[model samples]
Target: MAWVKWDQILLPYDYGGLNVSSLKLKNYSLLTKWWWRFLTNDNALWVRVIKSIYGQSGGLGCNSPLPATKMKIFSGRNWSQIINIDQTPSKLGCNLSNVFVKDVGSGLDTSFWNDIWIGDLPLKDAYSRLFRLEVFKDATISDRITITFDSPVFSWAWESQPTWRTEDELASLTNIIKLHKFSNNSKASWTWKHNSNGAFTTDSLMQVLTSLTAAKLPPSSATDLSPFVPKKVGIFIWRAKKNRLPVRVKLDRKGLDLHSTRCPVCDDDIETLHHSLISCKFASNIWDKVRRWWKFNQLHLTNLSDIASCSNPKLVTTLGVSIWQAVVWVTSYYLWIHRNNCTFGKNIDSAAKIFSDIQGKCFEWINCRWRKGALDWLSWITNPCRFDSIFTKNGIG
Candidate 1:
């Protein structure tokens, strides 16, 4: 009799003819037919299940769908009251079955449920809908249930399971983690290694060392001694002479007296290399005119070092070096030319005219070859007013 009642609860409303109530229930077939028609007619399938399970427990009276609430219960707490609160059977059944089936699949038979569930919320879907209403309700009350039944229940309803990564793939991930770790620890050294091929062989390294050492010294006493010597010595030799200096006295195994060598520029003093290059009175006048053209006040310059270190603004540093070499070459060249001119009775330009000619040639070379582009040449040559007008007319304003 109890089994019959259980079967009555398990069976769909349309399938049964056995009378367990013994009340001689009339219109049973008609009622069953109508029940099926009502349950499956227009509502979502879960609503139909809810109606069937708890229809007699005032469940049908609630107009609204049950309010769903989620709460995470700690391991040791009573899960039933923590997760579900309604005294209503419909809400109670849904909440309980959902929680229990999820727990069973996740807790006991993980592999079984993992293989089967293939859609969203598969474990919850299986427990909620796979069984007949009576069996589902009974399972909610059951204390011992295997994950095998749960897997099939969830799988038959088609729910997605969580994916697990393989151990080998996880092992491969450690290489990237190690690379990031190395980057954080050795960033500066690694950057330098990449830039210099693990060797500091460039001029910039010397510059860096100079800057570090210079920081500890007074500005006036600090000097950068890194050599700027060019590979071609001929360029330096050519620029040392003005036109071409004559070889008058070749130095043999004989040492000449100071009085024997007379100044080529002025016959006043002994003409050693240093006196001819730097200390001559005639060369001083030429240098004074050149300095005036460059807008520096006349300072007594008695040596090559003074010319090398002079900070005249008009002499562009690079051009200054080139000009210095040119001056040295031209002076020797002019001295040779002057001697030949004097011996053969040929016309020679004065020292002032020669200096002016050097300046003109230097300007011509700068404008034509050394300047970067036509615009730069124009800017270099044009007056300020004309240059500004050209820029404004060209829409570069």
Candidate 2:
């Protein structure tokens, strides 16, 4: 749930979600860049300074020429954590190495087996049996590949003779290395695999971390939320569908000892996400008026999915679908906002007033963003579904 909040926050506002990032994820994402820099930017002065103290901090660490008498990393050294991201327990599921990969050039700065220089997973992970039998875990790519005139030579280190399953893993690993192209011309570097330019961005890393965690949750069906609606409205719809909305019933179910989980507005039913957003006496009346305004049939919605999918495809063309979706989403967002007002003792507008506000905001945003789809205020309020031309799905006129 927290990850989802951060995801929405990081989304561009016009994409119909919130702004800002979860500070923890943001910090971790930023820290990963230091690891990237240390792995690739060997000549940079800051990287050099760290190498002078940390004394070759193992595979994929700075490979600068030794300054002599360097000590192992000790406490109070801030970069130690970033250098060991692969071994760290990440709050965002997998660690930094999962999103980043090694781009071997001279291969001096990349781990031959531990770093993800060759395949999707590190050789240590993909060939764990062979990795277990290996003596040197910190062998760099340059240590394994050597250049002799025009051709390259490859070598390996083994603790003991291989046999059986270990032999099989060694066979597969050998086959992979045989196909790897090595050159001594370019410097080895690390790259963020997710981006086109092979560079790091906070947003790109956050997206990967979010995706890895999202898979553990139940799948959501709220895809294709309309671009016509406000970001808050899109985020609200997404959360509601995923059952992550902070309605009283859900909070109480999660062991929040509320005074009552009853509907915050009407106090007629437990304020489950569905009831709070759709079936509450207040929300139901608002929905009825909104349906009437859009010339939609008043179907009795029993679930959040029903309300979210209320716009009829058979009745509306492309242009009308966008407008209708915006109206429905705006209506839902205000209903939730009004519910919060009631719960917090804020000024709760009447159902009519809330509905009016929803209409006004929808018209303002839709017309402003969709120049080709602009509507007269009278016709927009009267019925937004009456479209005969300029029917593009993106809401552009």
Candidate 3:
């Protein structure tokens, strides 16, 4: 659950999730610029500094001649070089194994066997048996090419004769390579694996990290609340869904010295995430009022997670279900705010007032996204069901 909270915090702003940056992923993103600088901007001061430190040729003020080829510069430094200047390396930094190259053009600078130039994998990886039998495993693109005055011809040099299995793999490799024709004028470049264009963007990097850790966390079944709800409400609902908001019961379970874990509103039982958000006396009253308005008396909402995942497939259209889910999220959010105001702000807002807050907020927020019909407080209260009328099976008008 703690991990889920962390993931929630790390999610991007557009997703209605918290904005927490992972330094490890950020460092990895920044390091991608290293390849970018090496290929594109050799005159960059940082590139020159790096080249000088690693004892590579070609820099701004260097008397030494440029390396025979770009491959020499690539071969000079290991991708996982550890350079500690004034500060030590952070344990948070992402591993080098996660990084790979994407060939943009000639594939000249990339290692033929090692780099991920073909598809989302390397030729060596796709044909491991052929890779093992290769005589020149570390050979670069320039080494294998036959340069004529007219145009460069491509060829491969392997060590051993192919068996039946190896022949099939070689044929497959030949077919794949035949699809990508190299140009003499084009230079091969490296790109981050996280993005489609092979460029490094923060959003893409965060998404990559989020996806990598997604399997360990419980999947969120919540509907798309970002289009209708406020960001604060969305975040509150997200926290509620994850069961990560700091309720007194959780504090007590953590061995914290608490006088009591009773709900501030009801004072009947432990102030658990479920009770405070759904089943508490105050929360239940609020939900009852909302249910009466929405006419969902049959719907059973036992916890915030239930509200988060309110989808009725039996309905003729998704608009009603989506609107109802948003209402549930909004109601639960205000109930929480009311509880906090009572406990921490030392002011008890009535259930009527809290429900009113929900109504006002939902109307204001949803109006921003809902465009099918004119929405006023009168129409909202009297014709709550009609909110779904503004939308259809396709989507909102």
Candidate 4:
């Protein structure tokens, strides 16, 4: 049975792949949805069930026995102070400690100091001294009196006078208070701040969780391959880079067919992903012509890693990096297809012809998929290094 890597399978469709959804990631998103419902729909059955279990610690901690036990044992323990790797507390638990509020419509449901409503940050954390001196720490949004529209001002009632050391906190509070505008008609609710829409999303959750995995991964140089390149092309590049392509030699090693596992284009050596994509004489000829055409004479050609390194935006101008990465991808795609055609089909295109085709495909991909300035085919073919100039001429960059 063929199985795609979880990361590749979940890539966006435009990146030369299927638009399959990961249930695990979807379930994580649903957990946030449940939280949203539990916080906003106070009378719902599930909400009642949750409140019965978790109780109201006001974003301090849950009422679960495990957390309760951990809190009792590790109370006042700063996470940074824990030197033991095995005993380090999980970050997933920490995410629950901060509750972001969406103060829309009537802002009565949210607590001003305790909840992270303002700019997705807590007022207490931002203004600790002022928070400590506040008369009503748990004051609801409605408790902050709004004056007349002609003279809009918040009448804040503090428990103690501001001290000399609290000047910075007072300044920050003044700036934050001015920017507190409510979104009309929408209900006041709590949402995960990780998502832009104030809702949970699998993509965002996966990014966060993948970052926290215990095992460290090798540093990756691959560009943002999806959403720019076609899915078929992107998937092909991904498999080839991983050395998992269905080459005859690889199939033979896996106890499949045992005959004729030689290079299809060159007929010189064993046909592996590297030989077919880069090392073979046929592929090298195409790469040579492409380098000269692009005027990148000093560019190195060795493996998929080299190609990936070239795709780094930091190495080249940001405006042209996407198109440059696409060019490398399109070249790899053409080489693979040419090898397949020669191996399985009756006809195969020459290296020069394949290079020409790659150039055309690159132009089409950049123009069609590009959301920035419109690309000119003549300009691209003439000098791709000047691709950014087109955007400058049109005032579009």
Largest TM-score belongs to which candidate?
A: 2
| Location of the lowest summed lDDT over 10 successive residues in candidate 2 | 58-67
List runs of model 1 lying over 4 Å from the truth.
1-259, 308-310, 313-347, 373-397
lDDT (C-alpha) at residue 77 in model 2: 51
**Local accuracy of candidate 3 as per-residue lDDT tens digits, 1-397:** 3525565456455443466666765675565455445645556886677666544323211112244475365544644232221022123333333354445465455567765556655567779999998888877766655446545566766777988999999888766766655655577555566668777665665565555544445554433455677767776777677677878888788878887789877898889889898889888888888877776645677656578777544344466666666788888877777778766857787889888888888888877777664465675787677644443433333
Residue 328 in model 3: shift from native, Å?
1.2
Candidate 1 achieves a global lDDT of 0.34
The whole-model lDDT of each prediction reads 0.34, 0.69, 0.64, 0.62
| Model 2 spans with C-alpha error above 4 angstroms | 1-22, 43-49, 57-73, 84-179, 184-207, 216-218, 221-229, 244-248, 251-271, 280-283, 297-300, 334-361, 388-397
User: Would you estimate the TM-scores of all the predictions?
Assistant: 0.29, 0.65, 0.62, 0.53
What is the Å distance of residue 235 in model 1 from its true position? Answer: 3.8
Summarize candidate 2's per-residue lDDT along 93-141 as a digit string, tens digits: 6655556666588777667776677776778889887787778888887
Instruction: Work out how many backbone clashes candidate 2 has.
Output: 4
lDDT order of candidates, top first: 2, 3, 4, 1
The digit string of per-residue lDDT tens for model 4 on 1-397 reads 4635565555444332344555655555445444455566777775565445434321232222235554455444432121111121134332543443555456576667766666545677778888888898788666774534623356677887788878677877767666666655536655666777777554676555444431233333333464457978776776666666888788888788655989878889998888988899988888888777777755565777766545542235555666677888888888888887887876777767788898888777777776756777776777777755545335334
Residue 322, model 4, lDDT: 60
User: Could you tell me how far off, in angstroms, the CA of residue 307 lies in candidate 1 after the best superposition?
Assistant: 3.7
Query: Model 4 misses residue 126 by how many Å?
Result: 34
Instruction: Judge candidate 2 against the unseen true structure and give its global Cα lDDT, from 0 to 1.
Output: 0.69
Residue 131 shift from truth in candidate 3, angstroms: 16
Consecutive 10-residue window with the lowest summed lDDT within model 3:
82-91
